[model samples]
Target chain A: MTKKVLVLPGDGIGPEIVGQATRVLDALIENHGLDVTYESALVGGSSYDAHETPLTDEVLAQAKDADAILLGAVGGPKWEQYDISVRPEKALLKLRSELELFGNLRPAILYKQLADASSLKPELVSDLDVLIVRELTGGIYFGQPRGIRTLENGERQGYNTYVYSESEVERIAHVAFKAAMLRDKRVCSVDKANVLEATELWREVMDRVSKEYPEVELTHMYVDNAAMQLVRAPKQFDVMVTGNMFGDILSDCAAMLTGSIGMLPSASLDANGKGMYEPIHGSAPDIAGQNKANPLATILSVSMLLRHSFGEAELADKIDQAVSTVLDQGLRTADIHTDGDKLVSTTEMGDAVLAALA
Target chain B: MTKKVLVLPGDGIGPEIVGQATRVLDALIENHGLDVTYESALVGGSSYDAHETPLTDEVLAQAKDADAILLGAVGGPKWEQYDISVRPEKALLKLRSELELFGNLRPAILYKQLADASSLKPELVSDLDVLIVRELTGGIYFGQPRGIRTLENGERQGYNTYVYSESEVERIAHVAFKAAMLRDKRVCSVDKANVLEATELWREVMDRVSKEYPEVELTHMYVDNAAMQLVRAPKQFDVMVTGNMFGDILSDCAAMLTGSIGMLPSASLDANGKGMYEPIHGSAPDIAGQNKANPLATILSVSMLLRHSFGEAELADKIDQAVSTVLDQGLRTADIHTDGDKLVSTTEMGDAVLAALA
Candidate 1:
C-alpha cells in the first residue's frame, strides 16, 4: 500500500494549500492504514526565481518517478514578462507534455451550500455535476508550423496546424468512454465536424471507440452550438469530450456553472496510470499572505487525488462529505460568503473541513 | 432618401420571425417618413428543398445588389445530413465568404423585463451591454488545408490551418477599435498568443492598432482566461475582438450573460460598406409555426442595421427606446415568461413595441 507523491507547490499561496493537503494525507496514513511517502519540489515562478528556470531536469526526474503529482497553482503577474520558453506557465506545459498526460478531467459540480454564490438560478445550479474530458496534449495547441513567418512580399502571416492522428483520437476517446461508463452512462463528443477535418477524424475515432462501451448513449454537437446549448440548457449534458484547445476554453467556461471558482478540482491522466491533480485556479498573488484566498478548491483536488489516483474510493467519499458538512455548518470562505454567513480565514476553513472529517 | 433592403427568411421559424421584423420596417417607412424597399429571397433548407442548392447564384446576386441584408435563422435537422458543400449552414458561410463580411458584431443585452429567463442573478444580467467583434473571413473556419487528407503511412490524420495575415488582423482590429470608440472606449483583444503564432501576430497587429486610437484602452487576454472571465465578470468588458473561430464560440458564451437568448441580435459588417443583420438564435423548427418564437431579436437586428450600416442614428435609438418601452409595459414572450407573469404572443409583442414607438 506504499504510495509516493510529489508535491509541486509552485508559488504564492501554493505552499500554504499544499501544506494543508499534506496534513490530510498524513491523517489518511495514520487513521486509514494507508502507507504514504511525500516529496516537495519547486516549479513555476518559485523555480524561476531560485534556479532561473521554471522546470529543472532534477525536479522533472522526481516527478516522473512518483506515482502521482499534486500541483499548487503556478504563475503570477511578476513572471508575466519572462521569455516564453522560461515563463512560469510554461512549466505546466512542459510537465503535461513530458508526462504525456493526455486526458484532462475537470468536474464542474455545484455544492448545495454555495448555490447562492452562483450567477445562475439556484434551481439551475443546484446539485448539478458535469465532467469534461478534454484531450490535453494534442491538436492545434501543439501542432507544427506554429509561428509567424514573412511572405515573399514583406507581408506576414501567423499560422498554426490542427492535426490529429488516429492513435491520438483513439486514446483520448477511450479515456472519455471509460469515464462515461462510470458516470451517467452518456457521452457527448463535441467537435466542429461540419467545418474542420480534424474534428471529423475525431468524431470517427470516437464512434469507433464508442462501440466497445455499449451501455453509454453517444451524441455529437458542433462547438458553436455546444457553446449556445451550454448556456441555453446545460442540464442536458452528462459527460463532454473534446480536443485539447476546445477543452481548455470550454472547461473554464463550464467551471463558472457552479458560481464559485473555489469549489472545483481537476485531474490530468496519462497512459500506464500516472495522474496529476490540481485546483483549476491560479496563484492569487494579490492575496498571497492575506489568508483570504479560498482553500476549498485545493482541498477538493486532494480529495480527487485520493479517489482517482490512489483508488481510495471510501476515503475520497469521506473527504467529499466532509466538504459538504463544513458548508452545511455555515463555515463560509470569503469567496462563498453571503449576508449573515460566517466567514472564516483560509487556515480556519481548512481546519473546519478537517474537523468535519472527524 | 430611398433605401433598398433584402430579406432572406432562410428556414424554420425564419419566415415567422422575419415577417414580424418586416412589419416593423414597413412601419418605419410609412409612419416615420423613411423611404425603404423590401426584397425577399431564398436560402437555407427552404432553398435546398426547392432549388437543390442552399444559396443559388440568383440569391447571391440579390444579396450583393441590396443596400443591406436581413437574414433570419438558417439550418435544421432536415438538412443536417446534407453534403458539406451544399448544407444549409454552408449557405451562411458562403455568403460571408463571398461578401467578405469580416467583422461580426454580436451584442448581448439583457432586457429589463426578460431578466428572469437568465440563469444568472437578475442584477448581474440586467442593464448589461457587451459587444463581441469577431473576425469572420479568416482563421480556422476558412483557413486552407482544412479537410481530410491521406497520410503516407496508410493512416489518416485530419488537418486544419489557422492562418492570420497581418492585414487580416489589422482590418479586424480596426473594426473593433472603431466599434469601441462608438461605445464605452475599452477594447480587449483575445487570442492564444502564447501558444499560436497567428495569435501572436493578431496580438501584435492589435497592439499597433491600439496606438492609432489613444483614447481607447486596449488590453490583451489569453482566450482561455478570457472565456472564464466572460462568465466570472462580464460587466468588466465593453468590446471584445478575436479571430473567427474563437469569436464564433466565445460570442455564444457571452450571449448567455443576458439569460435571454431570444433577445440577442448580431451584425456582420463588410468594411467596404455592406452588412448583414440577424437574430443570434437559430430556426427553432419545433416552434416554427406555433407563434411562440420571440421576435425581439429580429427587431433589434433591424435597429443595428439602421445604426451601424445605414447611419440612421436617431432611428436606431428610437427603435431601441420603443423595444425597451414595450418590455417596461410587462409584455412577455413565452421564452421570457415567469410564473404569474403577463405574457404576449409574437405578433402581439411586436404590436406592443409599435405602440410604444407611436
Candidate 2:
C-alpha cells in the first residue's frame, strides 16, 4: 500500500528545482523501504500553456486524492499579461481555496552555515528558529464584499474586509497551541487588538483556545511591536499565530531573517490533516532550465511534507541534517554561493545533499 | 491674533520632554515676534485621575478650535487594565475620529550625526530620507460592520470591513502626489491587489490618480514586498502611499531604519489642512519626571507643525538645523545615550538645541 504523493512542478524554475527534490524522494523510497508513489502534474504558468487554463479539473481531481502535495514555485513574467482570474499566481489561490488549506506553517530557521547571509549581526542570526502558524483560510485574504466598485460620481473605490469567525480563530489557535506543546511549549498570538475590533475578537477566541492547552504559555503582542521584536531578538519567539495579512507580511520578514530565499520552506494544512508543502521563493523565470536554480528550498519542502503530513519525524530529521551537512561541506547554489569555493550547480548541490545523507 | 495650541503631555516622560518643546515655542514667539498662544492639558492616565475622563469635552473643544495640536505620548502600564474601549489608547483614537485627521505623514530621515544608531551599516542608513503618506481616516480603522456577533450555532464571530470609496482613495492619493511634487516627485502605491479585492480597487483608484500627476513616476508594489524592500534598500524609496493598516506597519519599519526613534516626528492633517504633530515614540513610563527623557522628538514635532500647517518652511528649517546642531555637539538623551560623552539631561539637551539656534 504505497502512499500517493502529488508533485506539482509549477512554472519557471519550479520544474528544475522540484526535479532535484524528486530524485531525493526516489532515493528515500529505495534506501529506507518507505511505501511511496510520486505523481507529476502541471500547475501555474505551465498549466496555462498546456491547457489554456491555470488549473484544470483533471489536475484538481488528481490533487484531491493525493496523500500530500508538493508544489514548486509558480508564476513568471510570461503570465503577467493574462487576466486576473487566469493569471499564474491565481493558480495558487485557486488550489488553496479548493483544498481548504487553512493553516500556513512558515518556519524561520537560521542555519549556522549561512550566518553571513543575514543582514543582522552573526550573533543575532545564529541558532534562530521560530515557527509562525498563520491562519490562511479566513481573515482579510478571503473576506467577503471585497472588490473595486465604480461609484455614481465616476470615482473608483477599493475595499477589502478583515473578517474572522470564532471557529476560524479557534481552529488556527489550536494548531499553534498544539504545535507549541510539541516544541517549546510557548505561543505568542500577534494582533492589533487595541485598534481592530476583529483582532479583539481574535484575542478572545485565542483566550478560549488557551484554556484547552493549559500547559502551553500564551502571550499577546501588537503586530507592530511584533515586527520590531522580530528584528530586535528573533530567538525570543517559539510559535506565533496571527491573521492572514499580518501573517503574510511578517512571514516574509521572518524569511529575510534567515538571509536567503533559498533556505525557507512552508506548509499549508487543513482540518483533515491533509497538507501542501512549498518553498517560499518564487519561480525565477530568468534562470529556468539553466540548472542554476537553488534546489535546497524544494528539498526542505519535501522534508516538511514528511514530518507534517506523513508523521515521519525521523525521516524529516535525516533530510534536514543532510541539508546542514551539505552546507557544512561548503556546497552552494548560486543564491547561497558567497565564497567562490562553495559554488556548485543545482544538480551537484542536490547530489552533495544526498551524499551527505549517506 | 495669536493662534491657539494645545499640548497634551500624557504619561511617562511626556511632561518632561514636552516641557522643552513648549519652552522653545515660547522663545520663538517672544524673541522672533511670532504670534502664538498655548495651553497644556493631560489626556491619559493623569487625565483620568484629575479630570475623571481621558479626554474631557473641554479638552476636546480646545483641540477642535485650535489651529494646531501637539501630543507628547499616551498609554502606560497604569492604563492597560482598563476596558478596551476606555483604555488610554482610545483617547488618541477618539481624538483622530473627532478631528477628522485623514492624512498621516511620517518622515524617516537618518541624521548624519546618528547614522551609527541604525542596525544597518552606516553607508546604508546615511542620508536616507523617506516620507510615508498613510491614509489615516479610511480603510479598516473606521470601516463599518466591525465587531463580534453571535452566530446561529451559538458561536461568536468577529469581523471588520475595510471599506474605501473612490473619493477616499483619491484624497489620500492627492496627499501623496502633492507631497511627492514637493520632494522627489515619485510615489510607490502599495497594496495587495493580486489577492484582495479591496486592494484591486485601491490599485484602480491609484491608476486614475496617476493621470493627474503625469510628471510623478508612479509604481505599484504588494505590501509584503514593500516591507522587504524597505529593509533591503530603504534609500531607493522617495515617497510611499498605502492603506491605513499597511501604512501603520510600514511607517514603523521605515522609522526604525534610521535607528533612532527619538528623532522621528509625525503629522496628521485634516481636510481643511488643520494638523496635529506628535513624536512617533510613546511615553516611557519608566523614565517619567527623571529629566532623562529625550526632548528632540517633541521639538521635531513642533517643527512638523510649523511646516505642514503654518507654512513656515524657513522656521521649520531653523528648528531642524538647531536639532541637528545639537546632535553634532554630542548631546544625547537617555534612550539614545549609547554614544559615550554625548549624554545630556532633558533640560540641558533642550538648552543645547536652542543655543545652537543662536
Candidate 3:
C-alpha cells in the first residue's frame, strides 16, 4: 500500500515553497525504491477566497485520512480584515484540536556549513542538535474559565487557570522519553515546580512515566534555569520537554540561537504518529510570488514528516544530507544570503538539493 | 536628620561581601558629609542557628523602620536539610511579602572592562544595559487555589491561578515608564496577551498607563518573542516590564547575557520607593571566609539603593563611577579575573573602589 501524504500549501510564499518541497519528495519516490502517494489541498486565505472558509470539512477529512501532513505556511495580511472566527489562522487551531495533536516537536540543528549563522559562538552551537517536546493540546493555553471579571469593588481582575491532569502529563512525558530513546537517551524536563503547583504535578507525572524508560536518563530543572542554560551552553542538552507556555518560549530561544529561522522545521503530532510538519517561520507575504522566500525550511519539513509519521529514518537522513550538501555547495537563498557565498533563487536552491540527492 | 540603613548580611560570603560595602558607605558619609546611620542584623542561616528562625521579630521591625535595606545573600548547602517552613530562604520571602516589595528591578549592564566575560560575542553585548522591571509578590506564584489534588476518578490534578488586578498592572506599568524616563525613555511591556486573558488585561492596563507618560515610548511584545530578541539583539531594548513568572525567566536570561552574576545587582521596591537591595548571586559557602568572593555586585546594590530609595542620583553615579574606575585600574576578583588583570581579594577590591572615590 502506498503511504498517503496530505499537503496544505496555505498562502503567501506557501505555494512556491511547498511546490519545491513536493518536487524533492517526488524525486525521492522516483529515484529511491519508496512507495508514497500525496494529494495537495487549499487552505488559509486561498481556501477562504475559493470555498468561503479557511479550512473546509472536506479538506480536514482528507487530512484525517492521510498518514502525514506537509504544510508550507498559513495566514497573510490579506486575511487580516476577516473576523477572528473565520480567519486563516483559526484553521490551524481547529486542526490541532480536532486531530488531538498533543505533542509538538521542534529540533534545533545547526549544520556546520552554516555555523556562522548562529548568534552564539560557533564553538557552542556548531554541532547543536536538541529536540524540544512540548505538550500542545492542554496546559494554560486551552484551560477553561479564563477571562477578565469585575470585582465587587468595581476593579477588574484578569485570570487564567493553569491545570494539568496526571494523564495529560503522563502522555507528554511518554512522548519525551520515547523521543529520547531515539536520540541520546537524555531528557531534561523543564518546569516551574519550585513555585507553580501545576508544574509540580507535571514533574511528578514525568517521574512516574520515567520508570518505564529505564534506558533514558531524566532530569528536572526550573524553567528560569533552563532558559539560562540554553543561552549559556545549549550543547549540554539532548531533548527538553515542557508545558505549552515554557516550550513556546524555550523553543523560540533555541531557534534564535541558530540565528536564522529560514532553515528550521517543526512537527506537531498525535498519539498515533500522524503529524503535521511545517517551517519554524511564517509566510513571507511581502515577497509572495517573488520566488525570494527560503524553501529549505519547508523541504526540511519533509525530512521531519518522513522520520516522525512514516518512521522512514533513512529517508529522512537522505533528505537532511541532501540539504546539507547543497548548503556545503554554497547555494544560498535570498533570506540566508551572506557575503562570499553565491546567492540563488528559491527554485535554484531546491534544484541544487535535488541534484545533490541524485 | 540622618537616614537609617538596615543591613542583613545573611549567609556564607554575605558577611564578608557586605563588610566591604559598609566600608565604602562609611567613607561616603565621612568624606561627602552625607548623613546616614546603619545597623547590622543576623538573618538566613545564622539567624536560624541563633533564634531558630531565619528572621527575628526585632530584625523585621528594624527593617520596617529603616529608610532602605541592604541584604548580602541567603541560604547555603548547610540549610538544605532544614524544613521548608524554617528554611533560611523563607526569610527573604517573608520580607518581600511583609514589606510589600512588589516591584523587582534587575539591571543587566555589561561593563566595558569585563565585556569579554560574556558568552555572547563582545561586540554584540559590549554596551548592553537593559533594566528588567518585574512585578513581584503577585501573579501565579502567589495566587490562590494552588496545589495538587486527586480528581474524582483517582487521577491527580495540579493547578495554579494566574491573576492580575487592574490596579496591580497599572502600578507596575507606572514603575516601568518612570524607570524609562530616567534612562532612554523606552519601555517594552512583555506579555502573553495573544493567549492568556490575564496578560491581555495587563496589556490593556499598560496602554491606559502609557498615556500618562508622553515622553516614554511604550511598546508591547509577546513574552516568547521577547526571549528571542534578548538573544538576537538585546541592546534594542531599554526597560522591559512583565509579571512575576515571566520576569523570573527573562531576568535570569538577561543576567546570563552579561555572563558574570558577581557584578549584577537587584532591587525590590514597594509603592513608596523604599527598597531592598542585593546582589543577584547566592552565598557561596564553599568560598566563604576565604575572601575570594567578589564584592562588586553588593557595592553596585548600594548604587541602586542610593538612587531608588534615597533619590540621590549623584551619589549613585559616584559609587558606579568608582566601580568602573576600579575595573579600569585592572583590579579583579577570582570570579571575573582574566589574564593581564590584577587579581584582588574581596577587601582589596573594596579598598580600590574607595581610593577611586577619593
Q: Highest DockQ, which number?
A: 3
Model 2 has a DockQ score of: 0.61
The better-scoring model by TM-score among 2 and 3 is: 3
Better of 1 and 2 by DockQ: 1
- TM-score, model 1, chain B versus true chain B: 0.94
Against the true structure, candidate 2 has what lDDT?
0.86
lDDT per residue (tens digit) for residues B1-358 in model 3? 8899999999999999999999988998999876899999999999999999999999999999999999999999898898999899999999999999999999999888998887787888997999999999899998887888898999999999999999999888888887888899999999999999999999999999999999999899999999999999899999999999999999999999998999999999988889999999999999999999999999999999998888788889999999999989999999999999999999999889999999
Clash list (residue pairs), candidate 3: none
Candidate 3 lDDT for residue B20: 93
For candidate 3, write residues A1-358 as lDDT tens digits: 7999999999999999999999999999999876899999998888999998999999999989999889988899889998998899888888899988899999988988888877777888887899999999998998877899999999999999898999999888988897898789999999999889999989988998999999999999999999999999999999999999999999999999988789999999988888999998998899999989899999999998888888788999999999989988888988788998898988998899899889
Each prediction's TM-score against the native? 0.93, 0.93, 0.99
Clashing pairs in 2: A159-B198
For candidate 1, give the DockQ.
Answer: 0.72
Q: In model 1, what are the clashing residue pairs, if there are any?
A: A119-B120, A120-B119, B118-B259
The order by descending DockQ is 3, 1, 2
Q: Model 1: per-residue lDDT, tens digit, A1-358?
A: 6889999988888887777777777777788777778899999999999999999999999989998999999888899898878989888988999999999999988887787776677777687788899989889988986788899889999999999999889888877887777679999999999789899999998998899999999999988778767665677889999999999888887888778877888999887557899998888888887887777787888788877778777888888888898889888877789888899988888888888876
Model 2 segments more than 4 A misplaced: A79-87, A148-157, B1-4, B30-42, B45-50, B75-91, B210-215
Candidate 3 regions exceeding 4 Å error are none
